[model samples]
Target chain A: MNEPTRPLPRANELDTQEFWAATKNKELRYQQCDGCNTVVFYPRRHCTGCTSGNLTWKLSKGFGTVYTFSVVRQSYHPFFRGKVPYAVAWIELEEGPRILSNVIDVDDPLVDVQISMKVELVWEEHEEINIPLFKPVD
Target chain B: MKQRDAAIVGIHEYQSRDVEGKVSALQIKAESAARALEDAGLSWSDVDAIYDAGDGGGMNGLTIAEYFGLKPTVIDTTNVGGSSYEFHAAHAKRDIASGKANAALLTYGSTAHSNARAIGVGGAGGAGRHPADNMDVFSGMTLVANYAMVAHRHMHDYGTTSEQLAEISIATRCHAMRNPDAVRAMEDLEFLDIRETTIDDVTNSRMIADPLHLLECCMISDGGGAVVIASPEVAKNCRKTPVWVLGSGEATKYPQAGGDITASAGAYSGAQAFGEAGITPAEIDIAMIYDSFSITVMVLLEDLGFCKKGEGGAWVEGGRLRFDRPSDGPALNTDGGGLSSNHPGMRGIFLLIEAARQLRGESCSQVPDAKLAVAHGNGGMLGSRHAAGTIIMGRD
Candidate 1:
């Protein structure tokens, strides 16, 4: 039997701490600029749109559409050693930002995750953190 | 006061297969630099500025200068991934034109295949404590994967077929057959015997990432490329004919949440370059755009105004980029590009060198009456953000 694969280490910066912490609670959160109503993922303090310092964290509906995807058959990372032929997707959230995620719980990702396929958050528990993955909705 | 004109007076390259043993990056860079100086009919004493792509690694310009034994007054180590050399050329052009430096040396060297660390993920000997580390969330979002995502989106939005992308690889291989310096590692054939592949051959090759087969991606090889940009007065006295740096532009799009992966900074940089050069896209005789992946060429073609945004798939179809294509538009990548030639991690310098060669009427697959050419370099990931650098070179 193969050893369970480990998720790559993530460096949670000060601005993105809330994002990682929210994942631990099985909630998907992103930051929005209070001044210009700009939505941001992979959080930062200032509004990228208007350079406003005021930003607020909002919970997503945990749903999104597949903007694009790739099936990985080759990877240089050791964590992906046994996990070849997996689907990595860029999900376009309803909140107007895109997230880099994987579409999970599928028998064949090639046929399942066509462009614009609806998906919802599916959190995977690692040692100390929860990684938010996506699975087909309906 | 008017700014002085700057021109590329010299260019050189070093390409190899690392099956022998370990070779230092510094040695490759130094040799290439010395050859470029020799080509320019100058010595190390003539160089007054150094520009290098020092991404992740700090102060690469200083290190290279110390190795080459030159004391440059100005140094630029701007690292924007693969496109750093184009940025270097852009910066060096301005420095020479503004009289900040009389001569600028731009060099790049990478032992990507020979060195295990160069080919491995997170393998650099550093503390690995950088802000960019947070961007690599997906273990599969490597360079090839990032390009695959772009191709996937392009197909989804524009109905681009996999066969359309394969045409790029086949067309490039056709040109690579004539380039002696190009490294052919895919098959057991000699570089000259590498036959033109069919769309089926490309589609059937092993897929590294979905929508991107092995054929569509660039080959890794150890290589070095260098260029010498000098004031027009200095160039006039050089040994070889000078290729004038007509215009240059660069723009960066951050890969954070708001950026569109489908879109690129090419549109902005291309517009700036054209505006500065006072030339339209139609005026160019040749194009030497970066091709880390086939999708990269198509996307840049659309973004640079060579075709309508969604028309890139059709624009390059039916052998439009081929030298013998019998089209009025510019011929592209007459040197086979990074896809079929050599990609030593940073490929921007090769684009500039090829463009200069075409402008000088020195390319093996030269475009007929080629006088003006465009070289665009792209760096970083697909969806999040990246840098685009465009340089226009001309011969009058």
Candidate 2:
């Protein structure tokens, strides 16, 4: 089969590259406010919680629980057609952040993916970006 | 609250993929506008004001207005990301408050599926020009990447897992199964069947920029939806029972959603709406929220005070969104949210229409005895860098 096409990596500012780099390792990391010690999700120069310019990057333990999700049985885009029955979810990280990701592993009958199933990291290599995925931990 | 005569006497929506048929954005928008007007039993000449709520894509509203052959003496093009309809309500309120407009019409449409770079006027009355900054979403974390980071942060902090998120998707799909317009809804589908789906499967799923898995983002639909807002008198004169906009509020946070989502968030948006409505969050009977992304809904869980700020992950653990439970808990998006509902170009209008229908007890699939309802919107992401509005609605 021919190589399926992919969307090129969209942005490349100096600050965002590191976060993307971490995704390739299947290890999640975020910038934290050095002042309030609040961990930030999208890497940025300042903390949104405490207005602190002091921020630091920390590696995540790569664990979380599903918060909310949906299974897309209809693909609105050619990019997602074959994956119609795929899962889309918002996993709350152990570090107090909520992000969107894919859920893998296990059998999904009505996908009782549940509201809080434990999950860990998995990675998918795209043409330009390595995407992070999660699977239910046994 | 200021007593006004405006009511949504009409409602309609298109599918999430009509843009695939190669229809121009304006054509789709005009079709929706006409459909809504016809549903309301009105014509274009009755509209004294017009508001165009479009994501920074095509400048189709004015073009459509011209094509429709109506002269709107009072007009605004508040092209906020997704909250355009609600924002249009705000604009109408301001116009009415200032005694500028009598009857206003709000319309939204997009073709994110066809064009990557949306084009519009460089100045006023132009489309694609949002009053808020778009650099972060279009360029920074983009859509998927930024939310991915937030999902990662959420996982690390609350110990939320991907399986939990997957469960949300699964449950929503079940809800979608009942909605005919839902782009994707499957009762028999499971997460594992899709676990192996590659990034390519998601990437091509309709790449609206990057890092956002095809599934992580909202549909880049080529359809349009519309609503007409008139003073209370005109509304009462119309055919349908008016679902009064009792109270409403709009809020903004940081300029960029590419960082921590905690500060300056949805709570502010929810607070304003509840405050304006003079009702506690506990009093809300039903909700039709904007679910542009899964994270948007999760954050609203905390923002609306349904759960503690970070406890949203645990709130839906038991499939509580199902209609089986008839408790004080708010019945939400009973027909399927943006996730399962029709996520055409202008999604907020769908929420507004559904909220009105629920209040009118006219929904095709009604939430039993739904009297008071909330229609919330997140124009962008968690931070509200763009614009987020909440409308507290009640049956008259």
Candidate 3:
């Protein structure tokens, strides 16, 4: 039997296609409402704050802090079952948007990973997209 | 219309968790519906409005109405995760008060455990990808991890400890010991230790995710429940004492780029519920909080105004949540709650059923003179996007 792979985003979503396309070049993109100066992540069409269609895409510096995290001791997904006790967190980016990612390059996730710990972005190159991950800044 | 113009006249919880595929989800729902209507001293024809969460299939209102053979007017198929029933109650209340429907029926059923499904370990699955799923699913975010993140943040922000979170599990287990219908009491499930749980029992349990032990999580049981709401005019002639729907509110919370993970939608929904009830949380005698996880109840306790913000860790420390505990706070989970009793996928309907039971002075672990109750249901994930529904009921 073929090994199950990680869940992938559907190709060519109208709102998020640009985001995935940018990831091909290892660029992390977020949106900022041009009208209200509001930051948006996850690449939405309109501003959540003001519902403004006028938005601008900005590249992230990929420096962030751990807003919150959990050391998942159990997962049933085929791709994740073997990787027990990995850390998943919401990273508070310096550019003012939080993104969900795995905190990689940690010895022990429960002991090393913590809230407010500074981290820098790294990329996990997949066939379709370069998934953004974070590692603790030394 | 007055807030108490609509009342819950009847409620029924399907007690079996070991259906073993002998019964279908729709079958359980139809049975619960018939039993609830019988409890209300009303016939099947008395139900003019039907409300369901569509857990069985898409277009739930039409599907459920057709299955029950009802062709009435109002149909609400609000599926906001688990809190859909509370939202349904709010809509049913409005419909009944406005003369749009005299008697409204809300029903739910799930066979999660019997199907041997992984409740929280598996990430949400769908046929096609959505924009939000693309962003988060790659991280391998399981449902338990989502709530575990919230518990981690709460501990970080307020110095909350694992022992403090364990207190919630211990208290609910105490109530579970008193409930004969709790999952622990199932004779065939002899593998389960039916003894009362201690804080150590909770803390020492295997960790599913960081900051959450296995004992702190709710049981996955195959069960369902039904609720009947009617206008005051119809309530007077019901079989049982009417549990007046004094107030209700529903709201949604999501990650707004970088929202507070510790705060839940309960802050908004609970306030609207209590404000419309014209009473404070202190006036509540029983609190049937959705205990999907121990942290769920702890966070909602603070967000629902039962305690000050960031003070929930200290607040739940004692045995204060027990029905028999002598405290100023409301008795919690008098029917054993989702934590120890029964949680079949969407547990919102059980909250309403248990709250109505307490108000009728019929709970297994009854609180004396329980005149007022609050049933708060949190749907989706607390750490991610979620919905909250709050309902306050009073006995006449």
The 0-to-1 C-alpha lDDT of every candidate, in the order given, reads: 0.78, 0.60, 0.88
**What local lDDT score does residue B144 receive in model 3, on the 0 to 100 scale?**
89
lDDT of 2 by residue, B1-396 (tens): 344435667666755454554776667667877777777777787888888853434665556568767888776777656776877776676675566766677777666545643111001111122212211221122344345445545655677654444434444445555566653321111222322232234334543322234454554445567777667767767767777676667777653323445433557777877777777767677767776665566667667877786777777666565544447367666666655555654578778887887777876556777777878877655532557778777766
Best-first order by TM-score: 3, 1, 2
The numbered model that scores best in lDDT is 3
Q: Would you list the clashing residue pairs of candidate 3?
A: none
For each candidate, what TM-score against the reference? 0.93, 0.64, 0.97
Candidate 2 at B130: error in angstroms? 12
Stretches off by above 4 angstroms in model 3 are: B124-128, B183-191
Candidate 3 residues A1-138, lDDT tens each?
988776777658777888888999999999988888888777888887796458899999999999999999998888888788899999999998899989989999989999999999999889878888999998
Off by over 4 Å in 2: A1-138, B1-5, B54-62, B114-142, B183-217, B255-260
A42-116 in candidate 1: lDDT tens per residue?
577777779645888999998889888888777766666467677888888888768877888898877777888
Winner of 1 and 2 under TM-score:
1
Task: Show model 1 residue runs off by greater than 4 Å.
Answer: A1-4, B1-4, B17-19, B117-132, B183-193, B255-260
lDDT of 1 by residue, B17-55 (tens): 353346667778778898999989988999999988764
Q: In candidate 2, residue B125 scores what lDDT? A: 15
Cα-based RMSD of candidate 2: 10.0
lDDT of candidate 3 vs native?
A: 0.88
